[model samples]
Target: MSLEDLVRGAAAEARRLAAAFPAAGRKDDLPWAVIAAFDADVRGHVERDRRIEDERDRVLIASVTLAETPAEAEAEEWDRARRHLVRAVDYLEETVLRFGIVNRLAAKRGHGAAGDPVSALRRG
Candidate 1:
């Protein structure tokens, strides 16, 4: 799948996981499963983009840590997970925007695909 689609899917899953927290309760395993799948998708994307890997890795790590850490109360844990999910969604949305901008710029420059913008410019 395209990076945009992968990111969108992950974002949707994150939102679903966030929504599940309140109804599933702390002991439920469903949210954890969703989180694991989401993390894998994010990690795979990060791995594919070495240029931004460090920054994205940090964000992913921080979000996962925050989301996974147990709180004294169930409510607090759910709240934290929801907040992290919101940030994840925001990050994914920004990524989608960046992809759109890059694709537009590539098309304008007469490139057939959004691959190595610098190289395309050098060729031109």
Candidate 2:
């Protein structure tokens, strides 16, 4: 399965099990312990996903900082600022989509795409 589907399924299962095993109730299932068959792999995915998000944030901050420098420039400077913004947006869009943040945020804002989150499973 694709990473998105895998993450989604894991999220669903975690939700389902949350009531039965509340976060506060677990003892032996410490932060270092594996809770399920796919626990380790899922943890790795989460770590990588978080790293990507962190990188995205850094890129955005850098872009904004660069953008500020051109804000007071003349016509040519405005063009430079526009270019900077475009590059920042492009990089962020790709990173956000790779992390499925766009779809997840869209769903939260009632703008979810019709595309299946598990389209790969359906294809096979």
Top model by TM-score, which number? 1
What candidate 2 gets wrong by more than 4 Å, as runs, is 1-51, 70-72, 101-124
lDDT of 2 by residue, 32-114 (tens): 12124224323333323564555445444533433344334576664554454445434433443344332343344343333
Across 43-71, the per-residue lDDT of candidate 1 in tens digits comes to 43332444344434444554565446565
What TM-score does prediction 2 earn? 0.34
lDDT of each: 0.49, 0.39
Residue 88 Cα positional deviation in candidate 2, in Å, after optimal superposition: 1.1
Estimate the TM-score of every prediction.
Answer: 0.45, 0.34
RMSD of each: 7.7, 16.3
Displacement of residue 43 (Cα, Å) in model 2 is 18
